[model samples]
Target: MIYELNKSHFYKVSHLLTGDLVNIEIKGVVQGYQPGWVFVEHIDHPKTAMIWSKAIDGFYFIGDENNTDFNDYINQFISLDIAPRAKDLGLISFEFSGTSLSWDKTLESVFQNRELHRSKQFTYKYKNIINASIAEIELQNGFEMMEVNVFLLEKKLSNLDFVTSMILDWWDSLDDFFVSGVGFCILYKDQIVSCCISSCVTDDAMGSHTVTLNDYRNHGLAKKLIHQFLTYCRDHGFEPNWDCMEENLGSRLLAESCGYTKDSEYILYHFKLY
Candidate 1:
């Protein structure tokens, strides 16, 4: 039977299952950052008895239900059929099987740069260099650092603030460290202009790392910030990665200009609640 989840219940279960490493939490369940995914707990089932599984393209399932049963759930919820697959790089805790997902080269590049591909001992060196570059650019542009903070999903269902909660949920499932990613913002004349966030995934691996705000467009600020972030990731034994919709030409161009290649593309299925 389909069940409705309240925010508090969702948070309680999601935290019980994924811990503080999760990104998307709302009320109580896991939401998607991209499209075509949902993280939910089977309310009637025991938490410890639950099983989590991930398929291709960030698709995940919770509980001991088999693929056929899960497919039934997907069809019922979204009116679509999906096959399950075994665990892959993006799948953190579970395994299933289906067609492999596709990603472009640029997406791959973003993932690589997400982690700086270095060891922990050198992380500060990388961060200092990147931060210094950002500071230098800010000084040159007369921008001021307004805020620098790290977000930690210590509890459950804290992702309602973002547009892509489900994708964030899936990301949290795979990389526990992303729960504490850092966000940096720069302000001009007391108006927030540029901002970026860094992930905990290694640079060589495929992951999401950076995002810049709008209104600060066309200033090469994103490129500079990303470059510094990448250098930081490299020095700290991590790689850097970034991704945007294929239709986002501006982002594609920026990534390309900054040495990111075109990665493969995967269809994102979105289901809106009535």
Candidate 2:
């Protein structure tokens, strides 16, 4: 029997789900910040065949899902009408991770009538970089890497518009990096121009985000923030990592400059709610 997991199971499952950026929100799930849920074949039993976690309009699946029971769990949950409620959000995506081979069969066994399209996304991992990384080259004419307090999440929240909203929404994960001084921002006389934060980190790989005020584009601030973020990863145990939709050339180039290359890609299955 498949059981819906409670927050208590977070610590055990978080590490397993974190390799992907969306799954890293497992931090919010464990911290009780939002309505996140996980389903597993066995409740208290160790090492069950499959586990599924519900993300906003999408879901993330992890575990050794090569077995038939994994397919059974999908049918069992959908039979309970999980589909209609999930699809009510319009369109939803399912992202699968890890070395599981039976995904095509498993999906076929369940959604025989639904239309699903497969798309690929790449995530880069750092390889063969020196011990210390330089955070900035020459600050461009208009911008400078201003000194921002590491623990001042509130000041940023009250001052900026877009970045503030993101920080407020995902405070738990951002706070983990904020308190550690793992990010930086550019300033131009009191108005925050560009900023970067270590978005998420696992034992092995670290994820990042960069933003700049609209008027401040082409000022080389994004790279400066990224270089700083990568440097922190160098000193720490985590590998500098980046991931984006396959179409985002800007993100791809940014990662390339830091000596990172495309390491792994995942398939995203998109389904319409109609």
Candidate 3:
């Protein structure tokens, strides 16, 4: 029998299950945070089943427990009329200690390369790396200080705007990094100028992060915003993570400039949904 999970219970249990890898510190309608949801499985006994949460509906379980049965769970909780169709699901991990690292066969297949291996030297460098050129633009007359807002939720896809929707999509598609926080633009005269989203996760094992905007390109806003987020993460016990498609020159240059060493490589997979 599936028991309804409350906010307090889900928060407590998710931390216990993932060993604090998942955090529920933002405010939202649900018990956790945006784009991520947690559930406890009671197979045979409610206490014995593994606890699982998905950030951006991409990967279902992290830190080991049988994920083979996730489809069954999806079928059980999601109904055509009540839930969004299952788009994709998979697993990914990063090791920050070395240049060589080994990923699962599934990851290699997703990246479409067979030479990817798990070693200290291979793990810290990003495979299929991409670098992007930085554009410089002067701020308007009303630009001011930067700020960050972190929200916790108990459900998925809460009241998000158009830009937030794109950010969530990007987070779902990218496996080498994870969303660390969302940032809003500040104006010199106290008016809002732009907004950006940032992430924290490793490529192979090296820490990195990135920030992106909607229509505010060609400005140095992203660089400053990402730096603020990185500083926050570092101060809060998280190592920054950065990675991108091999062809994404803009992202690569940004990461490298921010002191992210291209240490290792890995693969990202998208499962076909029927």
Candidate 4:
């Protein structure tokens, strides 16, 4: 039988998570620095584990994939306990800590009837930045760009809160976000049109979340914002992290343009709920 681990004991499985250090979401949740759930094969000493983050609708599995009992229990738990309630939470996406044919085979078997969708996710590491021409645009009229802070968020000016909330979905509160988070936004007529921010953060790295308004695309706004964000991270000694679906050509191109080199790739399995 599997057991749910108390948040206090979440650290028990940290060693198993070394394979995905760039996944700040995993670090955040596992450390209880963010919200999530954890389950293990053994309450006293776990050999297998599952962690789920509600904010991102993401699940991560780690350790002992060859454990038949744990595998059987998890398959049932996901199908009967989790799958039925997925709609309430959001569509669930599954990722594993390390590459294991055993785990991969188990995933296919467990989700065979659940319409599992698989895709590749690419992670990028910050290298030397490719400086872009943003000063001319920054000097342009009606374009204002600035760092995001408590004061700026507190002002509640012109859809800033909405965009911040939408992009920083992993953060529970603005207070929590500003504790270590950093972001930059470009505004047109006081309206935030393009922004890039630290979606997840740790002592040495910061994950990225970038968005541009639909009508504001193709104007180099995203590039400018990313360049500024990366510059800030570089100056402050934090490595900027980026992850995107392999199919997202635009996002991949943008990251490459900003000097983020592809570091690793992983698979994500999406399960839909009725």
Q: Which one is best on lDDT?
A: 4
Q: Scored by CA lDDT, what does every candidate get? A: 0.36, 0.58, 0.38, 0.73
Which window of 10 residues has the lowest lDDT sum in candidate 4? 130-139
Question: Model 4: which residue pairs collide?
Answer: none
What would the per-residue lDDT of candidate 4 be over residues 121-199, giving only the tens digit for each residue? 8889886433322233353567778887866666646887656675458677776777777788887876888877778
Q: How accurate is candidate 2 locally (lDDT)?
A: 0.58
Candidate 4, residue 85: the lDDT equals 64
lDDT of 1 by residue, 188-230 (tens): 5644455555432321322333444566677766655666555
Candidate 1's TM-score: 0.44
Count: clashes, candidate 1? 67
How far is 39's C-alpha from truth in model 1 (Å)?
Answer: 5.3
Candidate 3 per-residue C-alpha lDDT over 138-176 given as tens digits, one digit per residue, 9 for 90 to 100: 555555544433331211322334334445543443222
Candidate 3 Cα lDDT to native: 0.38
Off by over 4 Å in 2: 11-36, 46-57, 76-101, 128-132, 146-158, 169-181
Backbone clashes for every candidate come to 67, 0, 54, 0
Which 10-residue window of candidate 3 scores lowest in summed lDDT?
94-103
Q: Please, what is the TM-score per model?
A: 0.44, 0.76, 0.46, 0.85
TM-score for predicted model 3 compared with the true structure: 0.46
